[model samples]
Target chain A: MSADFATCYPLKRGRAHEVCGPGATYFAATCCNFSDKPVLWVCPSWQQEMLNPEGFAAYCDPARLLLARAASQIDLLAVSEEALRSGTVGLVVTEIFEPLSLTHGRRLQLAAEAGRTTGLILMPEGMGSNATETRWRCTPLAAGGDSTLQCWELIKNKSGTFTDWVTRWDAAARRIIVVSKTGERPRVARTAG
Target chain B: MRARPVDAPFALTAKESNTDRIQCLNTRAERAGLSRGMTLSDARALRPDLITRPADTPGDAGFLRVLARWAGRYCPWVGLEDADGLVLDVTGSTHLFGGETGLIADMRVRLMRAGLETRIGLGDSRGAAWALAHFGEGVAPPQQPLQALAELPVAALRLDPKLGIGLERLGLRSIADLTATPRAPLARRFGNGLLLRLDQALGTQPEPVVPLADPPQYGVRLTLPDPIGLLEDVTAGTARLLAQLCDKLKTRNQGARVLQLTLRRVDQGSQQVELRLARPMNDPVSILPLFERGLSGVEAGYGIDQLRLSATRVEDLAPTQIASAIRQSQTEDVAALITRIGTRIGLENVQRMLPADSHIPERSFILAAAAFSEAAPNWPPRRARPLRLFPPEPVAGAGPVPPVRFRWRRMALRVAAQSGPERLAPEWWLEDENWRRGLRDYWRVETAQGRRLWMFHTPQQPGWYVQGEFA
Candidate 1:
């Protein structure tokens, strides 16, 4: 009767520190490019240029669909900003990981409360954010063996509590097991009082 | 040669004894004991020297059969009737060889020079001609056997001894007697067997004569007047035959995929040479040269008198209409070129590698025919691969980072520059040799001069080997 927290919070205590924040729900969108955040790569780098947010949302190429189908923890989207504004998705994972204004955060908080599907925005390295449920970070780890994969992580949960954990990733089985345990921290409100 | 008995010239006369003295004897001499060759007195004493020369009956028959084949050229329905006569049905084609009489004279003149004596008989039926040829005295008027054979003796009918005896016993020795008798009385007395033969000889009955069919389908057969001994001559003969056969195929709107050449030697044996084409083609020039290479290795012992070229497998000749803008170089028809090469070298020699669903490089490709080139596209997308791949080479290190030095073959090299622990798990569903050994973590390690190698360390086997290297 409880939701799958592991699937919902795959970036907890990981190198994806800026995206995961202190909140009951979160949303983010990670694409091949972080600089062009709202502009999801609907086509390959060789295709026509990005027109507008609506135009980009309509672009559904096979390669993007293939990647979308592979996503285990979250549902992939073409327009994360629209999903957040319309309260369609609980969490909008955007490629943009910049600090949001109070107004933007309020809109996202309202949308996340409305939709059940939380969005996790995948940001590139060195990107930071001010408003999020958690700021968990992730990096490719050394492979344990032929079948086992390790990913470096940092978890920033809803309580604004931070911890580090080495998660073993089984790509074949699509399961992530925690290897090195980190300190447990108290939960905190993500939105400003 | 000088002495012989007056009654019996010779006790035994072989085929060619001294016959000069016997020839000097007067005419109307008895053949007494002159067997074959005998002295004059010996032959005369026995009985007398009989006039004898040589028996050329068989030689005469052979000559007549040749003339029959020549006559067959006109009507194509000519058969030698016994040893001395030919029966030709000039019904439809008599005008081609002139009229019936002209044709007969022409045949006779040709036979005369070939050292043969003959008689001419023309009739509406074979039996009439046969009877007239034997007993008509001179060139008889063309007649139906019933009328022209009236005066001819029973012997002239060429009836077997049993039938002749039966007729003679009945006092109906001549055909005339048989004709006068009523059909019912004849049937009741002697049965109707005699009537059947009479009707057959008169062309009133249907007798099925089986003709030999040309054995292979797409064949061209050539018969030379004189046997050829030279290889060049044989080659030329083969070329002519191939050309003719190709023409036949072209009109049929088909092309040959395989060809078989039969060289019939004069010594009663034949040689068959076959060649396969990668693609179907009917052009003799393209196919002839292909087989000529194969013929070079054949031992044409004495000589060849006949050459036959036949197409074994044929395909519909769909002439491809190339767009005018498309390049019209010789290389445009790759199938034709491949076929030519395949013919000269061997079809098995031209092979292509096709991709299968396997991570293992060795297991990835399956050898296929060059004709199946369409099955394979540019393979192995640009990924760093080894120049060669052995089984996984054993590595000492167990942790994440690859071993600095590992033994491959007998040579050991320190890792100069390495990338990747790209893990490719063996498909468990597929029973693979590598799967039984466990999974592999592949690494692209480069030696000196960008000599990149793909090395995999088996987790189960706990070893590694160079799998492949990129070019």
Candidate 2:
């Protein structure tokens, strides 16, 4: 990637980015790293108890994270929309068990735009269809020593071509480092024409 | 006062138990030489176009309470004088309508228009005011309460009727006659109440009026001409009340934190729904929807005759800054969002993190209620901590040294890499059961299976346990 696109991942303000797989939370946390403002975490009430504040401190300040627990999936979506519309929050991350409909995604996008905030939806793997600007599937790889490796497949992008990248999440340093330019699978050789 | 027939003379009667009597007589009925408190049969003999109605004592009391609340517009301090009267403390408020005389006149006219007969009194003391309103000549506030009260009848002191008759038998037909007698004898004869009443009316003794609490600060009430039972009607009423309530809040520069909607049914029973906000707000548009959800639970059985919206909790609302358009919009949006979500879920469940003062990993941060607390502006610089921590789970591995392999949660994990043992001692000043192991040596271990686990070894117990995991 060139320097121009190095810092930016096509994640624009007022847009929704869908991250799926076991490493979704980690990827969403990394996306949240773009802004220094407060972030809203909207999830199910049961999920809230399992959330470890120490983990989020890696990407965003713990004090900057506000937790909103919803009793149901509908409430979760509503809370995310509300938080996105609230211009005060820089980022809104929602955990949904089911894929959001196109209308709901569009509404979230509009609200995010109006508030000048970003929204990240964390959903289960393979639940692909969404209105988000970009969708990435992340899978946690075996650790190489102390650092955890993750492979992200950019399955859909509204502004760019499909690509893949291998990255290392350094827990101690609390930073994400691109590990390789090639995709996770070995590159196929071709004869020169 | 006479409860006369509307058009013609009628033999009317009021029944209390078995003793039926002519409680009130009309002009023509009285002209037939009939008097009040006469037996119903005697009134029947006079002329028989008889009609009677039972006196509604509870209805009268309810009307009196309504009147008292209505009087709050005139003065914030209003008290019920009796079942039939309302007392308003218009000390400073009278000037708003011009003066005491003007205020009284205005109130009289308004009450008359509302189909109520009213008499107002003003005095330096409550006792003096009560005496003047009930017994003295209908005059302006007296310059000298004692002199003005001296000419009134003895009953004007608000004495028991039997006591008044006894005083009259003793030649004390008027207050002047009672005042002329020696104080000691008067007290001994009529009991101490007479002198106390006299002193209180004369302004020598204190007679403080316990004014009713000011009407709900952000409340607006609407009494319908006809009862409504439909949900839409209730919502419409709520919207109307919210607009009025918001206007009141705007004037006072305050916002409601909790609101209560009372629906008074025609059956004389009332149902109330309370809505709590995550943030204080005065905007009616945002407030109405919250009431909409709460309205579902309110039973509008029969039909609702009155709807009252009251802000039970209020806080001073500071003006929003317009310096930075973007910042202002964001702040307002966030606040509004918080309020809306809070109403739907609950305010207590919304939480924000605050940095706590402690070196212990678990004690380093605490979750505080978002509505009551503010985010800690300066959190301590980040240190290496696991992404997730669970209650210490025992690991089937032993040693002061790193274990080559371990079994946790039915999974076998071979340690591929390991970090140092960061020693942390128990906080001596505090008693924690989890920390009873005295001291712990923590290690960051990366397993071959890609899981990074935080394991701790308590030297005293000689066992290793997985305490947290890094995402």
Candidate 3:
């Protein structure tokens, strides 16, 4: 209900311009406050074998985040691939390592629209933007005091709005809080991690 | 004493004043043209020939009481009317034994074997039973007392002479004539006594016979032609009784959940073994082993004459299909196996975990016998959990993070990769003893040994512990 509750938003570059894209894309950010509508995030790599620290951390972070948000009727039924295909989850956040079929993307798009759930995809850095609501590229941000940091991003939002926005990250808290509200020149801060 | 053939003529002759004219036996023989209370020699001198025998009062009474008990087989409820009489209220049950005639015929045959002469009365009242036993000449007449007792004079009632004369003078020659008189006049003149005889004969006055107390709620009874001695023999005997009990369950369309096996040893002091089943079952094969296990080492002092197996707690058990096709068939069959194991280990030793409708892992279950437990419903919605869960291990830590180094099961490991601070707060309503340790931060940590395990560190206790390992 308040400004601090808006925890995270799409990362910005130079100006807080809108995002546009050609191919189907996904954008996701964490909620800062409680609402009746529960927040859902999905990762296709949830079942992936954790070969390294980064990969293992990737699996562990979402689980912990979901557990933290278990306060608001946590429904974990969507972890199954079948559940993802059915769009049973309110929000989907899948890491795209390989190319997905167009049919898969269309089904996901229709399901997300029908179920009123946001679809978020983590894509590789090389692929240029295609038809999508929003597209974002993020790298680790500079740290702030007390486990807080910020991220740089390149986005393709179809709305042609808020393309270049900074992503603030709190690593110790596993939280990403947003600073900019309006589409304007973005100011950034750096801190030692 | 030598036993007499049951069909032989047995007289129930009692002394009568009018019988003085005829020489027979006992006091009547002496009184008839003989000396008063004279010796048999004197009685023989008067008649030249007189029959004589000692009175068999106790023998007859004892035999009659036995017959009364046997009569109980006809109806669940039966009572002894008097010294030489039995009162059977075959009101609704006459048809069950194939009407009064067949029942009387059956009783006659059984009695003949026991050496008794009987006069059966099919009546609606005790008064009618007495009247028929003493006065009725035929086997069974109509149930109507007036028509059945009409030919018999008023003296047939066994009343005193003055009372008979009064009834005769009142033109009440038979019970029918007496009942025909107005109740008001009879009460005024003959008093309630005459009316009582009338009402009792016609089946209305509450002439309730004291019925024997109901047979024990459940009886374990046995019948064996050859008595048994060895423990194995006793088990076989018990098996037979268990079969009989299952037959009874089938007839009732029910099954017994709890059973009592009684061993009536020839040496006296009976032994009782109680076997409990997880669920009510009527099949003899399933129940026999339960008792047999108890009987395997039974010490029959001398021998057991009979065996009795009775169902204590019975319930309806319908047939069901065995599910050998299910994925969990192996686990399901383990229940019957456990019950067999219970035979050696004692039934109480067998225990199973039943899931309770709760989210908390430890509190979500109760222990019961697998045999008796109801099948559990599908698992609740939650993250993929290990089939096995250990008691919460105390971990050393304060803030939520995967420990860089932690010791578990006496082994210290450096976290090769760390995953979570999945904070799990204890449910406030549930009183968890470890709640004092505060919230838990669980992490899936992969060790250098390539064994991926789930571990948690308690923020309150300031320690790290391994909870489970991923396969």
Against the true structure, whose lDDT is highest?
Answer: 2
Tens digits of lDDT, candidate 2, B1-471: 234325555544667689888765555777877887888877777767655555566777787788888888888788888666777777778789888778778888997777555566677777777777877634434557766677788888888989999998988887778778899988888789989998877777987667776544567899999999888989998999899999989888889988998889999999988888767788898778767667887787889999988999999877766677677655556566666678677876678878778877777778787877777767776566776666888887777866999898787898888896998888999999899887889898887876678899999878898887776
Model 3 bad stretches (over 4 Å)? A1-193, B1-217, B223-227, B319-335, B346-353, B395-398
By TM-score rank, best first, the candidates go: 2, 3, 1
**What lDDT tens digits, residue by residue, belong to model 1 across residues B24-124?**
22213433333323464566556633433344556656666667766666566677665446766556676765777777788678766664556777666
Candidate 3 chain B, poorest ten consecutive residues by summed lDDT: B5-14
Candidate 1 segments exceeding 4 Å error: A1-193, B1-216, B322-337, B340-345, B357-359, B372-382, B387-401, B448-450
Please, what is the TM-score per model?
0.37, 0.60, 0.38
**Span of ten consecutive residues with least summed lDDT in model 1 chain B:** B1-10
Task: State the lDDT of candidate 3 residue by residue for B239-346, as single tens digits.
Answer: 677777777788777878778888777767688787877566777776666566677666677777877777888888665455634733433233333444444444
Per TM-score, the best of the predicted structures is 2
True contacts kept of each: 0.00, 0.55, 0.00
Q: Which candidate leads the pack in DockQ?
A: 2
Docking class of 1: incorrect
